[model samples]
Target: MNFIKSLDDKVWMTAKARYNASARLNKKHQALTFTISFLSVAQIVLTFCMLVDICFGFPEKVLMFIAMTTSVMILVIANQSALGSLLIESEKLHRFGIKFQSLYEEISLYIKLDKANKSVEEGFQQRYSQLLREADINHLKIDEELVKAERKSFELNPICALWIKFKNLVAIYLSSFLYLAIPLGLLWGASWLK
Candidate 1:
């Protein structure tokens, strides 16, 4: 009886551990997703501010330059974060966690209700084998999803089509440098007009 109880405990522990890992991975990817989105929006706003500063000079040209440089940094970070998030496949991780939780519940119930014919240890092994098969399938699907996601580029909103075009035409770092220079060049040109 004690050995059977220990085996049951082991199955629960294993499932819980897997569920926790998946949940943690999902959270990390979710955070990266949020960060990338925030940075992208910030980059767009900064670009707009730079354009306005070019047309109508700001009170502090130095601050405007700083803002442009900062936007470039933000863009770089956003791209990298997006790439990382895509690699992690957060959605798949989240789905797997939920599914694993369901499996754990089912196994627990099975242990409780269906203990008539087989020994407790045998029943535990049967449920555990099913869990392992499901887990294997989940991992394969996630790997495929990750592959597809990694192949995709960092997509932006419709409003960011211009940035997408720019990215396609120029390398990211070079493009970021050009973005940094645009506001400064425009400011310099504006100053010359004065």
Candidate 2:
């Protein structure tokens, strides 16, 4: 009974860790996607502005030149940032997190049922093997040093982490409004207002 309890505790902890890692990775993936989209849109908008200036004799040639150059640089950086399996790995981590959660729940159920007719070792081995296969399929290569550094930097302070996340959300929304929504609204000002 004690051994089963210990095993269950270990599995639960592992599952919780997986879920936390998944959330972190997914957040990174989302941030990268947003950054990529923002850079792409900025590039298009700046190009359009440049063309308009070329045709209409609108001033601000120097300013537009600077903006275009900056946009190009941003686009390049964003593209480079995406030159990885981040999205695929994030999705796989999410699936693995769910799997861990499910396994945890099953173990909890087994424990509550007094372990009758339930082979904890067998169940754990099966689920753990599945997780291994998933890791292989997803090519999940975790850098322990980086992970440890990140955890030490971010996860140590819950309040700060929450605040940072809130800030990121606000930045994403504000940038979206500024870069996409406002321009779109201006483009269809009359129709949209009506």
Candidate 3:
């Protein structure tokens, strides 16, 4: 009875520990997502402002040059943030995968032990059966939960990919817009000089 109870207690403890670890990983993932999102927004805003300045001729040649430089800086920052978020999320997933593998191995050992002692005392038999059932159920539940988590993590991947692509596109588009704006600005300024 005591042995059965100890086994049950250990199973519960392991499940609880895995649950807590997964929750912490999820929170970290959320923080990283938020950071990437915020940086993207800031980058978009800066790009828009720089485009507007180029279109309106607000600060002459010097102002346009400054605007272009600032936009490039924002693009660099956004790219770095996006890359960092991807790497961290991948690390979290790897850790969770390891935990799952370890849990599976431990459960398999317990199952094997239970099978080997099939001719034990009736009380031992009953306790073994009960422990096996509980362990199997708990493992299934954890696996299902992990599946949901993996799905969510997969969803975030494409979003991050799109964001990176969008940032690159914006950078290219704005750079070209500024390239054209520079010569046009010079021509307009030359006319003013005349």
In terms of TM-score, the best-performing candidate is: 2
Tens digits of per-residue lDDT for model 1, 1-194: 45545555555455444443454445444544555455456557656766666535444555456556556656665675464653455444445556555655655675577564456457556766675666532333333223233333434354455544443234223433444456557556657756
Clashing pairs in 1: none
**RMSD for each model, in Å, please?**
14.7, 9.6, 14.2
TM agreement with the true structure for every prediction: 0.43, 0.51, 0.32
| Model 1, C-alpha of 14: deviation from truth (Å) | 2.5
Q: Which residue ranges in model 1 land beyond 4 Å of their true spot?
A: 54-120, 137-194
Q: Which of candidates 1 and 3 is the stronger one according to lDDT?
A: 1
Q: Which residue pairs overlap in candidate 2's backbone?
A: none
Q: How many steric clashes between backbone atoms does each model show?
A: 0, 0, 0
lDDT by residue (tens digit), candidate 3, 1-194: 45544554444444443454444444434554554455445445645766666434344554445445445544654564454553455455445445445554555566557653434434443644554454422322333333333444435466555564454344324433443344346545655654
> Against the true structure, candidate 2 has what lDDT?
0.54
List residue ranges in candidate 2 displaced over 4 A.
52-65, 68-78, 115-119, 122-134, 137-194
Backbone clashes in candidate 3 total: 0
lDDT of 1: 0.51
Error of 3 at 27 (Å): 2.3
Query: What is candidate 2's lDDT per residue for 1-194, written digit by digit as tens?
Result: 66556666655555555554555556665665675577567657656777666523334554355455546545554565452565666566667667766877777787788844446567675776677576643312232222333455335466655555555455334433443443334334434333
